[model samples]
Target: MTTFYSHLKRSALIILMLNSFCAFLQKAHEITYVVGCFENGTTETLLEFDSDEVFYVDFEKGEVEYTGPYMPGFDPSQLFQDLQIYKNALRNSKACKAIVAYGTIMEKQPSEEKDPPESILYTAEEVDKGVENSLICFVNHFYPPLIKVTWTKNGQPVSEGVSLSRYYPNQDQTFHQFSTLTFTPTETDIYSCTVEHMALDRPQTRIWEPDFHHQHFELDVFCSVGLILGLLGIVAGTFLIVKTL
Candidate 1:
């Protein structure tokens, strides 16, 4: 999540710039690369690449190490030329130019941001056959106070009974939001709530099934029956003891 970086012509600056560039390339575009340093039997990789081919050179052995899928026919040397063009274009871009004109090596420091909300979907009340039920999509502990929540039923978008709550601040300085969808859930009904936010790379979804509610209901009934039977047995034992005494 580290973003903006300044280059001071020092080791710290070099590490900062390289890490920021790697994050920008991976997140803004799908391009990926990693830079590692090995010194005194200690190796540290500043950035990690996920799901990409890696070609590494061993300075001591004068060989290469590869771990994942690779295309042997692809000439990776072209990437150098492409990188030069990309560098020039970025330097010429308005944002980059503005940052340079500010007499700084980089723009403002990146934000210390929070992640997207934890979302859960559940029924507000006991679900009954042939009765309308309200499904609550509780989204909590997110930052920035901006999010989009949507509901779907049986793989189709639902809107009629949907409602959204205003973002509220939490004790930890984060934000929370809620969404509700009311519908008459049947045995085959499947409901889901999806939340989208700037902090998330993809939308978070939570699904609710009618069978889940039924399963919980059955568990509750079984526990209640056991408790009632235990109470009856205790009462009969007490009465018999008192009568015999």
Candidate 2:
């Protein structure tokens, strides 16, 4: 899990490909090696290996420091040497230049050409009165991760007991995210989830009522009883026909 988290974090940080033109002309190429520290499940880039200056994030003090970048199981010298080799290669290779050009082209691509997101609002289980419930609004198949989810109860905005999850990547280069609203439902309370994105001209709203769940439960029970009576009638008719034969 730690390895996976580190890979994901590095993937997010390594968005900009370091392809410096005129590497010899500049004192340092645009290459930054980051060494992130993880404790429990939280991780942050604590060490930044730069050619000019090195720094780390001091989350506890709420400030970043440049005094000394050090970690227990890391050697900055080897990292610097490896980066230097790559920077030297970047100076020589025509393929590297082509890659840099391609990356530039991709960066300038228009957002309008990308597909919009699809969102669905639902709950983990049936919402019942006086029971703790989790109302989830799922937004998926989105190209960009810009989205807003709001929950409302009785036509009023609800902010408490709400949490938004991180953006999870999909296989097709899209993203998925979820927002949860935890509350104890009541008989007359009406809940709604609204989603706002660039794809929609107006906010998309989905409403939920506790009474509907109760109605569905009652309908299911009624259907089950009707099915049982029909089966009994069929059995009795078959027995009577056998006796007559």
Candidate 3:
């Protein structure tokens, strides 16, 4: 009777331990994630996947960042849907850091979404049809970094007789992108700026001055600018001369 009673007690304890272990496994399989946007910017964390490759990044890193798994296959997209909760997750999650090592687990990459570089349209001080060599101005409203400014004439890239200035940020938090192209701009010439970025919808601008002002306002503007420059030069030269004396 004592031996039989011992056997019964051991059987009950084994069953209880098995049930508890199953409950713990179920809880571990639950999925959880977090998304945060600090002062630097916004980002998402995809937790506990089979792979550990960091796929996406902010694209302002001075290199064109085009990465990620865009196509959604049945197995990959479905399995990944369980954990990824980014609104633009699949689209902006293309970081190129995936590789197979020791194991063949699939992975996802991170992508950056920067404000698209604005289109540049040439705006002149004049507003008429025919005039001689008017001052050509390129005006574009940008959002900030991750952009390169270049000028093209007649659809060909050119760098001669051109000038570029640092971006000016407005009080309202908009970026002002400026580049100047100097040439004998003719009606047939198409002066434009090409902006390069990671997005397929990058920047290719064609400023149509089809019938803009051509009045010779250079003298007035030139005189004003010249006077200021002259005065500055005189002041600087005077300071040097006085110091030498």
Candidate 4:
């Protein structure tokens, strides 16, 4: 599967090819080739196998980076040379621009295949006041692979200690992403995660707050029940000893 993206035009071109040998062997494998061309004459190329990145072209460094081990009988040097040839051909060709133009036109003609993302915001660990913890915002089942996720603390936008994961493909061909925020848990503080995507009419936000009172109440009830059960056991043992004697 090859996917090309033109960020300047906000469109994608996908090409799928299957290897007969792999199919005959009953092994399901996938190859992903990505070419990202920008308006500033900068290009990005990546090759992945089985969803794991194998190598990428570092245009800035003018080198090919081998991120992972290659498949059997595959030579990294040969692959690098082949990529150079492909890159040179693409640089002098207008086919990418033409495909992006066609994709843009197709994008305008919307169909009925939009899936809105479902999101949840929660703490990574049990809430403890003044203790550092992580908040996770998971968004899944979204289409088109474009989304914006933001975090806020007490109604103010939070920037520090935030990280986002790369888009992961789901079985249904939709995508899922995760955003994380790190902060100290405070009883009076509140947090929210907001998600924006084209499939939704408006942005969705999920809020989270620490409820120490409720937690304490449940703990108290559990302890009280345990104490009562222990007392009952002790009383029953004493009565049995006395009757036996």
Candidate 5:
């Protein structure tokens, strides 16, 4: 499925400043209003404070949802006095539908360009043998916004503790997504994440494995050096005491 969006934004700012010889303080806050219409006949209206979502209109349920904490001294009722925001969103959706229909009839649809995705696989924390950790698969910069992600351990499919996130839009109009797997690190286990999308001729895979042997070797060398130094220090102390006596 493909979706096109018509976006509109409104902003209000509040600034306060206090200046004196001893101290100076300034505080500035902004409220953003956004309305959008999707090609699938869905509409979204949002109110954000400092880029954090505070309120959104749920057209399907015919209600306004409070998505974030209440802001002191800000009254949401004022914005919905006559439900004008909802009405505007409905009108915008209708206009978008009409435009899409006209474009279809005229054979003037948007360009069908495909952008391939880039993916990376990494562990959430330092990998240690027998330690529970999470593997993250990040995929970005893909167009059309549909992709499949799967995980495998030691060449076998892994289903438990796998999760996929919703698509997030990028500034270039492409999209990004994330998938995660929960697994325990082992010296002999290998993990892989595979991503498949329409833009790719074949699926892409990333692999990860633990470096337990390397880490253990480094630790052993460190401990051996420390033991040698400790023994030399004891011998030198004994020699000093006997000569003084």
Candidate 6:
């Protein structure tokens, strides 16, 4: 009787082990089809379907085994959505480096928010006239490593006055490349920074108007008053010397 009991226990253990192994094998092939299924392989690939929208095939029961209820309604292609996701991530980076020097942050998704797509950069101060105007621009993706940064005044392209910096890496393993377009625009003119980068889903843009440009009228007024006072002093000195002599 004890021998029979031991035999029963061993059979149960073997069955349990087999069940676990079969389950593992089933899971392995379920997701294997998605490894290289981007653009020319599988239509409903990994990044394409959201949670619970995946399909798997299994044929192991008898003659032919089928699995899964094909989900209803066709979803749009995932490649477009994937690019949009990446585009949004970069835009929301709030890198200060990403916006126009004089313009506020533009539209972007949360992935690029003020955190470290690069790092917590040296926060820029508000514009101080005659000191330096910090550049804020949206990087226009051109190629992989090379990009062009140029200034636009009232919709005209400029050359020879732009600055490009080395690309930095973000915490997310992506790169933070920057370029600047510099132009001293006037109130009557509109300035925009155009960049063509390689990583953006599409061309990114940030525009600066007269108000956002931070041009200070008070400074101009003070300089004008000083000039006038100096000229008057010169005139008074010339008259006084002439009279005394």
Best candidate, lDDT-wise? 4
**Runs in model 2 lying further than 4 Å from the true structure:** 1-112, 212-245
TM-score of candidate 4 against the unseen true structure: 0.66
- What lDDT score is found at residue 87 in candidate 5? 73
The regions of model 1 sitting more than 4 angstroms off are: 1-112, 212-245
Candidates' C-alpha lDDT: 0.59, 0.59, 0.41, 0.72, 0.70, 0.37
lDDT of 1 by residue, 74-136 (tens): 545443434443333333333433433343334345333555789888889987766898999
TM-score of each: 0.47, 0.50, 0.34, 0.66, 0.60, 0.31
Where does candidate 5 stray beyond 4 Å?
1-102, 108-110, 221-245
- By TM-score rank, best first, the candidates go 4, 5, 2, 1, 3, 6
Enumerate clash totals for all models, in the order shown: 0, 0, 12, 0, 0, 20
lDDT of 3 by residue, 1-245 (tens): 01111112111110000001123645533222212111123222232222222133233442222233344553444555555334344343232111111012221232232345455455444434444343344444443333576777777888887676544333232345566665564556666666664442655655554433333465568889999999999999999999999
Cα lDDT of model 4 by residue, 1-245, tens digit: 32322333333323222212234377777766555443234455566677676776665666667777657898766766654644653553355556556665766753435679999998899988898999999999987677899989899999999999766555465678999999998789999999999889999999999999999999999999999999999999999999999
Candidate 4 local distance difference test against the native = 0.72
User: What residue pairs are clashing in model 1?
Assistant: none
Worst 10 residues of 5 by lDDT: 9-18
Flag the better candidate by TM-score, 4 or 5: 4
User: Which parts of model 3 are misplaced by more than 4 Å?
Assistant: 1-113, 127-144, 172-174, 209-245
Comparison by lDDT, 2 against 4, better one = 4
List model 6 lDDT by residue over 1-245, tens digit each: 01111112111110000001123545622212121111111111122122222322121221111122344664333324444433332332232222222122222221221211211111134543334444555332222223455667678875556666543222232334655554443457666665554344554456665553334566677899999999999999999999999
Which window of ten consecutive residues has the lowest lDDT sum in model 6? 12-21
Global Cα lDDT for candidate 1 = 0.59
